[model samples]
Target: MPVRPADIDLAQRLADAAGAVIRPYFRRPAGLETKADQSPVTRADREAEEAMRRLLDAERSGDGIIGEEYGEKPGVTGRRWILDPIDGTRSFTAGRAIFGTLIALVEDGWPVLGVIDQPVQRERWLGVAGQPTLFNGGPTRTRACPALRGAIVATTSPHLFAEGDVPHYMALVTAASGGAPRQGPVYGGDCYNYGLLASGHLDIVCESGLKLYDFAALAPVVEGAGGRMCDWNGDPLTADSAGHVLAIGDPARTDEVLEALRGAVDDGIAHDH
Candidate 1:
């Protein structure tokens, strides 16, 4: 089903609810805990997600929920609400305002609506399928970059990449800098990078080790702003996609980015022999 106005409203409401829960804990110690994967989680993350879940249960009880903090909850409707109450827990712990709350409505595996809310900054980006993305209630479009050379690319961090995937990530960074010595990508921002890209402040964002809650909301925001968000192979993102994600502000640069990644993989294979 096409995304209805009501769905968009609910997404914004969800972000607002999450933001309200998270704001009080910003810059204050919130009882941090490490998950099994060594990722940090805090009371803010848990409480914010729980707040959003409560709203969903009351308003859209039939929709499935897939949250970063809480486990999945199945529903009768094929629609699912994917959420990451705090997309950058590390940044949040350090009191950086780059962290954000992510909410997306995925219907039958495709993201149809998304919201990226940075409560501390009071900035919000909402993207609905078939509509332009909005930043703080005003329409926004990504800047055009015709080529990979000189593109302002961003990734949360290289440390997050798996050992085998580091080279491929670096290859793209090198390509973006025009084959020069790798100057490195803009580090940090997490989901906030995607929001900036939607607002024309960034060009590309490449990330791996993401779950559905990470990129599902991002595709709508990026694509709605005349950009493209896809896998390394340039395939459209879906619920079942592997974690590798590439977001380019200009659609024209899609092929070039994909080629860079493919070249890296091929070079690795050649070296393995």
Candidate 2:
């Protein structure tokens, strides 16, 4: 079924709720802890997700929930709400405004609506399936880069990638810059990079080690803005995806980037022995 106006509206409200809770903790000394994987989590992340969950439980009790802080809460409806209260926790802790709150509604395992809200920047992007994306109450479109060469690329950080994955990522950076390191593919945007891609300021974002909440809201926003988002292997992103994500502002470059990534994988494997 097609996404409805109400779905989009609800998504906006959800983001707003999360933002209200998160903004107060931003830049302040937050209680931080390391998760099992050594990633950071803060009070801002927990409180924001709790705020959104409270709102969802009251408004749409029948919908399921998948959150970063808390685990899944299943409901009778096949539809689920995915929440990433703080997409760039490290950035938030550092007093950077690049972090965002991601909210998405997935129906029967497919995202139908998404919202990327940067509360500090007061910039929000809302996307509904089969419709144009709205950037801060106005329509937005992705810029076209017909080829991988010279295409601007951004990733959260190279440290997030596994040790074995660095060679593959370096290959992508080379392809994006035509082997010119200074031309393109700067680092450190996280989820904000995807928003930039939707707003025509960026060309590509490739990252690995993402969870459902990390990427659930992203595909719709990128696709709605005339871009394409999928796994590095060029498969459609889903709950079952392997967490390697590739988002491109211009769909034409999808195959080219994928081929480069595939070649990188092959090269890495060949050298493993």
Candidate 3:
């Protein structure tokens, strides 16, 4: 049976699984390793997935689970739990308070319950498709910025940033609606930036080099607040495809920006292909 939207507790328990893994890591030095992609991997990341998998099997026995560290377990039932145990591995490995645990439920291939748990920040953001989003149970809405001018867009480069793609990304950011112009250089705060998008504190987050678990749990919270999450071409996100994610409030502003991005990325791809 499909869990009802009122079953927020189910989602809550899943988020708690991540906290369980982090608790022990917080007590000792992080046992970190590297992925083939050159990204940090930690015991907390793997243990969190293993823990979450166990609960999902015990609680929602018939449902499937698609995880980042672990792959998928096709279920007799159609419901699936999509998890990113730690969305910001770099920050987590550094013991910084920026990464988050993402837990979401999808039924018939559509996201129904989404939880973005930032344990370090002591905030857990939750959303159901038709309900108001909550920042620790208080209702929240996206910021109603008058225009894109002065709107701040946040993003990060986990690895591919320095491979000469920076110039194109910078050009698009420079050409967006409006921006503050005082920096000799720039940087961003990673997955915490997505929390800003959920809070409406920022305008957009454009990213690539992502995996399914990286973006799955984020789509609902962003979309629930009247924002949008899409691939580089404005397509919907999927549990299997994590090519790109864009969080933007203003569609006109986003369409304007993404069109340029597609052109630039396409041009680069054409040269390489």
Candidate 4:
């Protein structure tokens, strides 16, 4: 059967519910807690997940839900909803505007609907499995940068990227060729940067130390907008495990960027280990 396009009405509804849950908590203190990894969390994360779950049951009653806070719940629909209620909890807790909500509808493990709502940013980005992305309900796609010399890249933790992520980071820096690659370390919004890439505002976004919820929503958005997103080995992403993602408007150019980054990171890892 043709995958066709995912249901937009359903996609928007899910994104909206997540956004609605976070609206009141935007910049409001939600009381933070420390996870086992010492990462920050807040009531907003938990509350947002709960609210989304309720809507999922009512709207797509049979769909399985995989969330950040509550983990996976029983669902019967062939489609699975992968969500990160508040991706940038650290930023959210600190009252930064970089945080946003990520949701993706996956059919048989492939994301066919991706929605990224940056409520505080007042931007709602979404796209179904085989279509272009929409920003605020308008058509959108990544900007083309033919060469790596001038690509601009974003990453969450540059310093921590040194250990295992060195190859991926190095590939990015070299791919820039001559274009300036800027790094202003900002935490949270793992999916937002991919949204930015889909909108033609960014060249690449790298991620490591991510869970399925962290990258699921983002994979579809970036890919839907005429870009390619995958782990370091060039595998398509799913809602699981920690891996590296290289997102760019053009695949050929992105591959060039990837090769350069891989070499650089390989050298760095070789030196360190």
| Reference-based TM-score of each model | 0.96, 0.95, 0.86, 0.87
lDDT scores for all predictions?
0.90, 0.86, 0.72, 0.73
Off by over 4 Å in 1: 179-183, 267-273
- lDDT digits (tens) for residues 146-179 of candidate 4: 7766677777666545356655575566556343
Kindly report which residue stretches of model 3 are placed more than 4 angstroms away from their true locations once superposed: 1-7, 161-168, 177-188, 240-242, 263-273
Best by lDDT: 1
Worst 10 residues of 2 by lDDT: 264-273
lDDT of 4 at 78: 75
Tell me which residue pairs clash in candidate 2.
none
Q: How accurate is candidate 2 locally (lDDT)?
A: 0.86
Instruction: TM-score for candidate 4, please give it.
Output: 0.87
Order of models, best TM-score first: 1, 2, 4, 3
Over 4 Å off, model 4: 1-6, 159-162, 174-189, 239-242, 265-273
**Two-way lDDT contest, 1 vs 3, winner:** 1
lDDT of 1 at 11: 87
Q: Indicate the TM-score of model 2.
A: 0.95
Candidate 1 residue lDDT tens string, 1-273: 999988888888899899998999999989999999999999999999999999999999999999998989998999999999999999999999999999999998999999999999999999998999999999999998977999988999989975577778888888999766565579999999999999988899988878999888999999999999988777899998878888999999998887777677665411110
